[model samples]
Target: MSGLTVTLQFSGGAELLFDKVKKREVELPALEKFLPQINKTDWSLRELLVWIKDNLLRERPELFLQGDSVRPGILVLINDSDWELYGELDYKIHNGDTIMFISTLHGG
Candidate 1:
């Protein structure tokens, strides 16, 4: 089987770390490329994060990624809906899906 292509969007200052490309389509290789331990055919957001960190992220990934997922103040939206509504990092990304990451900065 071929890979899945999805749209990634960065905003609310998240784009700064991604070379200022607000939106881009990425073709994620087969899940086996990332997880060869099992027969999983879907890519989870957690896996996607690792992929972005390795491929797309051009700057400090620490700012955009914390641990295994996005930083605390970064909001994740899947297809215009809150990612929380769809299990956040556990959400299985599909082809053509639009995933957006928005950073929330607090001024002191």
Candidate 2:
């Protein structure tokens, strides 16, 4: 990692927005170090989202999620574009690129 940034947002109103991130930038190595903190439970983003949907959003009874699903309810933007459109979770991110994990209902 050598100069990267990650923007995390959510659809559940303002409570989910990170007040501390503030369009900040960090080294790629620093960003990579945060990988463990971003819920990459099984070495992959999809796997992490599965855990998130089950564990975090378990109370949302009507919500159903899948590993490769990317749409209105879920949007993962990497480097300003949808990751799904560019090899999905396997998309390669370079230094200075920003990865934004957003749940729809925000600006999706």
Candidate No. with top TM-score? 1
Tens digits of per-residue lDDT, candidate 2, 42-62, equal 233454344334434434423
The candidate maximizing lDDT is 1
Collision pairs in model 1: none
CA displacement after TM-score superposition, residue 102 of candidate 1 (Å): 0.6
Superposed model 1: Cα runs more than 4 Å off: 37-39, 106-108
Please, what is the whole-model Cα lDDT of each candidate in the order they appear? 0.88, 0.46
What TM-score, computed on C-alpha atoms, does each candidate reach? Answer: 0.91, 0.41
- Candidate 2 clashes between residue pairs 3 or more apart in a chain or in different chains: 1-28, 1-29, 2-28, 3-27, 3-28, 3-96
lDDT of 1 by residue, 1-108 (tens): 346899999999999989899999889988887768858778989888988998999988778888999988999999999999999888989889999999996547
lDDT of 1: 0.88
For model 2 the TM-score comes to 0.41
* Model 2 spans > 4 angstroms off: 1-22, 30-72, 105-108
Candidate 2, poorest ten consecutive residues by summed lDDT:
13-22
